[model samples]
Target: MSTSVGEAVVGVILAGGMASRMGGGDKPLFTLAGRPMLDSVLERLAPQCSRMVLSANGDPARFANYGLPVVADPVTGFVGPLAGILAGMDWAARELPAAELIATVPGDCPFLPRDLVSRLSEARRAQVADIALAASGGRTHNVVGLWPVALRDHLRQAIVAERLRKVALWTSRYRTVSVPWVEGPIDPFLNVNSPGDLEEAERLARMLES
Candidate 1:
């Protein structure tokens, strides 16, 4: 197994969302401050993860240029982010045997905090929790959290056999903890779901890079 917090974790970019609100296209491919939003997610996370995978569905060829393994949700239909996360877990087991945990973030969340994995790891370890999640402005970013690969089977059962869909409901079964980040000039976990959200993200991006 990998030794360190960041190195021990595999990053899962949850790009499987159906961007119906953003006019029905891949939100990750949408331009944000002159580049694809996925680029921004990668820039912040690549260094902090031992390996990274894109959790998306329908035509993996669309993301071939990124050179990352793109895994689709094993479940049929767009169940939810939980299925995408499960796909990442299954991928890590087969491809990255050393990865003990997987950290996740929405693909459209271009401003993901640089310290995301480190902080989540620390929180999980310190609290002896099964899962560690990111919270900003008093709200937890459910998809943006660290999950154990050992629980992939249990998670699969939760989704497949139990029909568990909500992240909160699934996480509540464990000793889940949330690490808070101060949201200020820019909410580091901001995501783009609509055109207006994307426009706002442009301004946040300028502020972040400035």
Candidate 2:
């Protein structure tokens, strides 16, 4: 996927989830307001990155309409977002030679902040951190953060050799920083994990578009 954001960061949308609470379907594809939640995610994220890719683990054809290169988790057996992030890192390293960093977000968060990449990148640079994460309402959204493409090999070893599935655990080894975001009419990092969350997102969508 070719992006024109002029920044050397690739966006990774982690879409590979069981979504058991949503009845085992692609939660990102679920309609939020009148469009797919992933549509809203892409709308907010695309302009902040050099390009984007979808990290998923199913039949990729279902996401063909989104026009992103779908990458499956490098480590299988329901490892979690770290695997997806690794796949994204690998993809960025291989496909986007100029990309030095990757900004990752959960697929279900439709209203993620447009300044996410900028804030994370800025904080990472200022703090001289290896990674930077998003925080809101005093809670860190671990998966929504910036990672260095140069650490892809280390991440791979953590996933493959160490069998690490928890994102926080893996990130703890690095000099990570947090960039807090203020919540307003909507929490920019809100995730639609269940039908109830989807309903809330539906309500927030109208407010966002208004």
Candidate 3:
């Protein structure tokens, strides 16, 4: 299942989290290096993907300015990222029929490498994997992945039946491959979860800029 550079891939930002540890505010909209985190994610992913959609569970108006379609979890009630992934798959299936894969990244991960989609796609093709996860510093970053759109039905069934909610659990059921990004100054997949993490990300950004 080889994919060309121009082949359509839908990029999805999972922004629906309750951000319980971040004091219940929107994680994606948090400031990092003087810009919204979602802005950074979109800027990095826009060129890698042919089209983009946001998986968020709040008022769509907040993200409407981005001009990308905003989709909510069909299962509702903040059921975690699996719901967001399912919503993304459904969107790709209908809007971008040519999209064979949906590449996802957490909106809170401001430092995601620009080559994320390409690297994951390469891993998927190399291993003939149904899903590709990103790894850095010997740890798996499951949310950052390229998933075959064909898995939509299975995911939907799982979510609807309350069978599969955890992303790692779902990936374990598939032919999964890991794309290694081991040569960066920091973990390219670094996510900002707490205030301390936000400060750390800021520090890393400064170092990268120098």
- lDDT tens readout by residue for model 3, 1-210: 223355789999999887888898789999988888899888788788888899998789988778989999988576789989999999999998999899999999887888788888887888988999999888898889998889999998887785677888888889999888884678888889898999999999898789
Between candidates 1 and 3, which one is better according to TM-score?
1
Q: What is the lDDT of residue 33 in candidate 1?
A: 90
| TM-score list, all predictions | 0.96, 0.96, 0.95
Cα-based lDDT for every prediction: 0.90, 0.89, 0.86
- CA displacement after TM-score superposition, residue 184 of candidate 3 (Å): 2.7
Candidate 1 ranges with C-alpha deviation above 4 Å: 1-7
lDDT of 1 by residue, 89-110 (tens): 9999999898889999999988
Q: How many angstroms is residue 204 displaced in model 1 relative to the true structure, after the best TM-score fit? A: 1.7
> How much is 78 displaced in model 3, in angstroms?
1.9
For model 1, what is the error of residue 174's alpha carbon versus the real structure, in angstroms, after optimal superposition?
A: 0.5
> Which regions of candidate 2 are displaced past 4 Å?
1-6
| Count of steric clashes across candidates, in order | 0, 0, 0
